[model samples]
Target: MSTPSYHPAAVALQAVLALANETEREVADRLGLNLTDYRALSTLSQSGPMTVGNLAVKLGATAATTTAIVSRLQSRGYAERLRGEGDRRHVHVSATAAASRDIMNLMRPLMDATNRHLESLPAAQQDAVAGFLHTARHLMQNHLNTLSTKDTA
Candidate 1:
């Protein structure tokens, strides 16, 4: 019976995820949003306006679930559903200015600290770190896709 050892980078990634989860929870509480609603608002804030169907896809939620999330956000003044200009029938969900401002205000301190830390690293190191994060994000997305497929199956 031998113990298995994880790679240091993998352990560090886990730590990052744990901290990020905690941060998200705190932010959600402060914003008076549930985890899913905060996530939906964050996605809309970052990705701009998208249809409910598109948001559902992005959030890995069902259309009904996304609609409910949108409704909650609408009630909180964090999101709005806008009719398309060209196609009046097309509905798009967008994060309100208030949502954007609140999220940014909550996250700015962390972002600034992260930027400062990155700036202290050499350019080569910074690039390497960025590349590693990109790969990590891709791998996580693949895993998420696998899990979702398994759920469907």
Candidate 2:
């Protein structure tokens, strides 16, 4: 028999994920980078150097996947992995200057569009939207943490 139909919630979530990924991927493809690399570069641009494990967690990805992303970025000269001087095993990754500029340039249009759209909303509504996004992000993080814990148990 065919698989059962997904619930309404599942369908909505699938659509949201697909839409967001499709939009981001399209932009990234044009910029010669995948979503992972773009996200990693953006994160590094904001947060400076970070451990691979921390990067993986921040990216909501596995270490192996993040490692692959770091490897690709390294190969492209967009990022570098640096070992801490005092701690030999402490490895950190950061974006190259070129990568920082590229991400900002690539995201400029998206940022402008988002800002314009948000500006169209009433002031209170814009604040509400920002609050909602913050809460949504926290909720998603909690859900991911639960899933990860369950998966490895």
TM-score of each: 0.96, 0.70
User: Per-residue CA lDDT of candidate 1, range 40-67, in tens?
Assistant: 9999999999999999999988999999
Give residue 89's lDDT in candidate 1 (0 to 100): 100
Q: Please provide, for model 2 over 1-153, each residue's C-alpha lDDT reduced to its tens digit, 9 standing for 90 to 100.
A: 899998875578668778877877876786688777888877888899999999998998899999999999899898999999998899999998888887778778878999999999999999988986787678888998999889989
| RMSD after Cα superposition, model 1 | 1.0
In each prediction, how many residue pairs overlap at the backbone (N, C-alpha, C within less than 3 A)? 0, 0
- Work out how many backbone clashes candidate 2 has: 0
How far in Å is the alpha carbon of 32 misplaced in model 1?
0.5
Best by TM-score: 1
Worst 10 residues of 2 by lDDT: 8-17
